[model samples]
Target: MTTARIYQRPKNAMQSGRARTDNWVLEFAPSEAKKADPLTGWAGSGDTRDQVRIGFPTQEAAVAYAEREGLAFTLFPAPERKLKLQAYADNFR
Candidate 1:
């Protein structure tokens, strides 16, 4: 049986905008550990399912898809965002 992980997308550290972060993502867990190629030295795995990612508007939608596909899944809770409230003048202090 294939196992999957469902979680909300995290905000990118390099960007200030929250685009696409609101969607929940379903990703298949790697069946095998990645191995380094002897000649190219690039790390990769034969599990092509690792490259599949499906996005849903809501968490329930993501879970439903996994259940319908008979995939075992683990749902991860979204991380809480903490705002560092600071005034512009505080930067000078």
Candidate 2:
């Protein structure tokens, strides 16, 4: 049985723009723990499903797809957005 997680895309902290944050993403849970490469010291695993991510416009759509595929999934609702109102001059203080 494949397990997956459905959640909304988070806003990137590197940029102010919130584009594409409304979409939901489905990611497969890693089946096995990653092993370090002896030579390059890179972390990797044989489970490739973790590398795939599917995006949907709405949460319901994402859930539907998961159910249709018979995949067990956990849905995590997006956290509420809080805006901090600040003035340009407040930066000096």
Candidate 3:
């Protein structure tokens, strides 16, 4: 069984507004092992599915999709952001 991780988007450090936390993201753990090429020593990851990113509007929606797909998964809660209310006049100061 392939395992997947479900987590809400974290707010950006610079801007605590709802910029990036609009959706929940589902990421699959690497089903295949990655190896380095012997000739070039370049690393190549296997499976294009591992690179695919799916977004859900809500955390519950993300969980439902994983469950419906029969994917074993874990859910991580997003951190609460404390946004400071600043006025445009403060920028001059």
Candidate 4:
């Protein structure tokens, strides 16, 4: 089995107002029990070894690609958690 997630790169991560052409990235993570390299190049090392990716132009395109590829998809909201954490740390300082 594989899992997928989508994320809108934060403004700081983008070039201008336009989303990067490779904005949409599809990541496929294999079941942990398998403990093997993913078939696709998107796979990373360590705990996320069983992963693969496909890039797209837009969220819709990414969704369509995921559906066509018969892979599960998830959308990751912008990193509000990180910002919140930073704010909390600043308060303590």
- Residue 20, candidate 1: Cα error in Å is 0.5
As for candidate 2, its clashing pairs are none
Ranking by lDDT: 2, 1, 3, 4
TM-score of each: 0.89, 0.88, 0.74, 0.48
Candidate closest to the true structure, highest TM-score: 1
Highest-lDDT candidate: 2
Clash number for candidate 1: 0
Clashes by residue pair, model 1: none
Tens digit per residue, CA lDDT, model 3, 1-93: 978999987867687476758799999988788899899998777677888889999988999999999999988888776669999999899
For residue 79, what is the lDDT in candidate 2?
Answer: 94
lDDT by residue (1-93, candidate 1, tens digit) is: 999999999999999999999999999999999999999999998999999999999999999999999999999999999999999999899
lDDT score at residue 41, model 4, on the 0-100 scale: 43
Sorted on TM-score, best first, the list reads 1, 2, 3, 4
Stretches off by above 4 angstroms in model 1 are: none
Model 3 TM-score, 2 decimals = 0.74
lDDT by residue (1-93, candidate 4, tens digit) is 456787665555445553453376777665555334567646344656344566776888888987887878787654453333456568777
Which ten residues in a row are the worst by lDDT in model 2?
42-51
Which stretches of candidate 3 lie above 4 Å from their native place? Answer: 14-17, 83-93
